[model samples]
Target chain A: MNNMRVLAEEEETSDGVEVTWEDQQQINTFAKLNARLKGIEDKLEQLKQEKEALDDLSTELELTDEDQTVLYKLGESFLHLPQPDALVRLEIDQASVSSQLAKLGAVAEECERGMKDLKVRLYAKFGKAINLDE
Target chain B: MVEQKFPESLDKNPRGIPKAPFIANVEEYIGGPDGDVEGPLKDFQDAIAKYRYMDGSLTQRRKGLEDKIPDIRKTLQMVEFLKQRRDRKQKADDQEDDLEEDDENSEGAKKPLTTTFELNDTLFAEAQLDDTDTVYLWLGANVMLSYEIPEAITLLRSKLDAAETSLKTAIEDLEFVREQLTVMEVNTARMYNWDVKRRRERRSAEEAAKREKES
Candidate 1:
């Protein structure tokens, strides 16, 4: 017979319970395919979680223009203020806000690139498997 | 005689690193011929000292800064900023270290199911099937395959993890950007809405007409 099992739990007790090559191949192939399906499912879950986290981050980013406007106006008002104490404080505060916004803008661009890359990858890999959520 | 050895980073490949003679003519002349051969050993003493100081622990200094965060974290916003800042810093350091090791042998090694020849004990132990009797040409258990299967699974899990984190982080970043842009966009639309612009233009025209009426 061209069929055999290298070893099996059931066969430890029972003798000559031969497994065919065809059966072994079938089993191996099935195992591999099952593993592949599982991988896809896991990836899908990960992407979903990623989407959630992105949503949370976006909330932090929602106020750029208003933030800038408030900051710039404060700076302008500080220059006009006669009191040196208040003027210096407001000027420093304005500078800090501008710097923070600049940093935030940089981080925002990075996030956009990452999201775009993920979208492209998902489209390429899972276009057939899942629907892209708006 | 003390021989000069190469740095650890220089010894990656199979071939041995070439050792160079230490040139210390001034010390060599005073130490005699035999002592000249070993003259560089003193230089090594200096190397060791330099290494200790240059790459020595910043633990004390860093600890002081880290110590302050906990006290600051009593407030809500500060705590959130600290957590985010810490995570980013840790990841950045990990990336720098990974780059030194090159892409293949770094964190990428533990990545999803595709296997290469390197032996990793954790994956090996997890993947191995229980070996049954017989040392040679064993007819029963497929030990080789069972081992491969489990390791592959472990690798796959790591890969999936990386993919998941990246996707989530990206989305968070994009959402922030869009919302930020929209805030300005919303303000612009409010100030320049079609109805408002039209009304402003009409008001201007009416003011001019009133001036003509007055004349």
Candidate 2:
């Protein structure tokens, strides 16, 4: 057990630097940024999926006649409305979803930029000792 | 439900024995005029790497099982609650008809279960669950199916049992992997110490021979 502990410690400091307070702070910041980036990426992926589903629905709606009454899901119930009204509602939803996706994409880009800057600083200080990538 | 089967390799070793053989005498284990310790050290390193990889995957599997168990339990609870509420309403209705034909009393006895359900996000709306023999369950991929109360309960119960059994197996596999890791680490440490001792003895013996020639 004692030998195992020593071996584990060696692996941690294998980059050949004794961890100082400043270095530890930088490491923690990198971890926090990485986690935030991951969350944003997940949201971005989900929004993309939502956009694809909405597009498919729009294509199907275009094939239906304007005089037909279409069923639109609202909350827990369905609303039977004219095809024109349903198309308008779908258009409004698609617009909102697209705007949200754009905003998330911009934020994700900013996050990636920040991570890159941090990576450069960390690598400069620790050389090959610190691992910044997942 | 299908029976849960763990890997045969993990199940084969009931006794906790190190996969790598222990070096009783390090000198004899690496016996040679040159004392070639590199080959044995490389073998030990490979075994440790293999064990570490197994440990990593086992830990991930254990985590997945842990997350799924709670979801199964929650679903089971919901189904059981629905079944209980249906049974209670049925009993109340039968008693009201048998005892008296009072309209007001019958209305009170057949009162529906009122609750709030989420509309979207944080928004919710008040709703009442009327007397119904069937409930719909979302079977993923946009498909939903209606099943009677008794049938739903049985299905949920069976699913819960299977998830629980799988979780137990995952936990056992994780423990077995950890034990193997410890044994491999101890073997590596022993081999390393033996090599250092052998090198020191060789150096001191050479110095002694030089001193005798100077005298």
Candidate 3:
């Protein structure tokens, strides 16, 4: 009853299915949320691939202070850092970097929760998925 | 000319938000002296052109925002993934005390791992990897350096953090664009409805005058 009141203005076409102005607005919102969800999923997959690449690189070497000059990326440029110092800094920086991952994971989960909320609302309103493409 | 009043429903509600100025101007042009439709018709055309220009630019801006969201999302995801991988390894490393065991056995460990090293696209060399030998990392821009595994993981993590910050900003921008697009859609709909009502009134009045003259 409350939903019907909220969806107050209904228009009946030649064929008898009832639709409201509110429903149209909700449908548009649903479509936009769906698009955003897709973007989030794609980004997550790319992050995984980058991690795997780093794992492979780490498995291949035994670095020490006596080794050749090490190149570290700084913005768009690469600068030479002493192999020993680079190793020390990287080891120290790893803990903070790992924590950053945890924070990002939380953000990703929040995004998913928001999407689920929108999806439930959309399903309740339409009874079934509305095919805007058609 | 018969002074016929337009329907009350067609009149703009004074209590509500003012109707688009273009619609009111068109009414004045069509309803004005000599009842010349051309001046008002030109005004109508200019309004449509202006509306279309605004619509096109807004749509283009939305599309640009959409394209950028995915790219930024990818960078964010990459950082997250690297962090995850590092965390997992750190967990396993914490449970074990044999972090240097592999390297220690590399010298006396009887297994000479014969591996092919690809020096260049068409060049390869057979080399024996000792258990203690360090791994060489190919840092982009043709630079290579040997690093302990933990150091390498940390280095990658820093990159991930940088990427994540950029992605967060990009997503915020995308959300702002989405909000703007929704507002644009509502305004466009209201303007279109107003224009149609004005056209209908003009057509019906012309039809009524023609009928009266014929009789």
Candidate 4:
């Protein structure tokens, strides 16, 4: 957290250009939020890819005979199950992945909202003097 | 504002050793009678650039670890799963032996675990998984070695721990490098401000002296 803290000192003669510690702190918070949002975005992308893979597997499973023993990958290992059972398992996995994606998407939205609030406050105070864009 | 004066560097010891104090008083910190500003500013710029470079590499390292940790965990999970399945099969075989002696032929006729495996991108092949006591693992660099279930589990566990430790270190190093970069940037700003103040004061004093001589 020390790395996140900006220098906190008051300057007597500001000339409207000096970055007050408060502004610096807001900037730091914005930056931290930005990084967090980026991480969440990356995770969302990965989860989306996983969901796509699951969808492809589901399609493949549907084409197999009803009594055929299809393989459903659980964790890193595959489970041999009847076609219907495999479809059910794949649905469950897809649901779990979709839920994860939704959760991350919500968290990313919250992070973006927080960044927007900080941008508003900081921009109000510093105007063109600050560069809060990523 | 004065009451909020905290230590310039928030973390006292980021890497288990204290860092040199941030340049609090830029004029004095730069250290020249005439308030030599350019040289120290240039040095700070170079240092900031170095720190930025380090941050870039550390970020990449962190990403690599992030990708690797999950991969190791997945491999470890597979190994453990295989071991468990093998143990269960062994237990069932033992139980069957105790229950009946005539079931020996049926054991040989038992159905293999059939699965579809990807042979290449989007190309799948149907394969039967045989009940085996050993599994082959890729050890990287064109090397593949077979290990018994228990041995593979132990090896993978150790490797996962090492990878996790390295990931922790990489993240900490990235944070430290970013903090250093921030400190350098703040120093540069402060030095520039101090130089501007000095020049303005000197100019005002010169104007006052000229007016006194004329009067």
Output the better candidate (2/3) by TM-score.
Answer: 2
- Model 2: DockQ against the native? 0.02
Q: What would the C-alpha RMSD of candidate 4 be, to one decimal place?
A: 7.9
Q: Name the top DockQ candidate.
A: 4
Per-residue CA lDDT of candidate 4, range B1-215, in tens? 12212234445554542232367666566655475787777777766777778778878988898888888877876677567557756766777779865453334334566666667777877778788889898999999999998998999899989988897787667656665666678877777767766766676799999999999
Report the C-alpha lDDT of model 3 over B65-150, residue by residue, as the tens digit. Answer: 55554554443343333344345444545544566443422322233334454466768565554433234555669998876545
Highest-scoring model, lDDT? 4
- Candidate 3 Cα deviation (angstroms), residue A88: 2.9
**lDDT against the true structure, each candidate:** 0.36, 0.67, 0.47, 0.71
- Give me candidate 1's TM-score against the actual structure: 0.19
Please give the distance, in angstroms, between residue B82's alpha carbon in candidate 4 and its true position after superposition: 2.4
What's the TM-score of chain A alone for every prediction?
0.36, 0.83, 0.54, 0.80
Q: What is the DockQ of each candidate?
A: 0.01, 0.02, 0.06, 0.19
TM-score, model 2, chain B versus true chain B? 0.76
- Model 3 chain B: which ten-residue window has the lowest total lDDT? B13-22
Compare candidates 2 and 4 on DockQ and give the better one. 4
- The predicted structure with the larger TM-score, 2 or 4, is 4
Evaluated at residue B214, the lDDT of candidate 2 is: 95
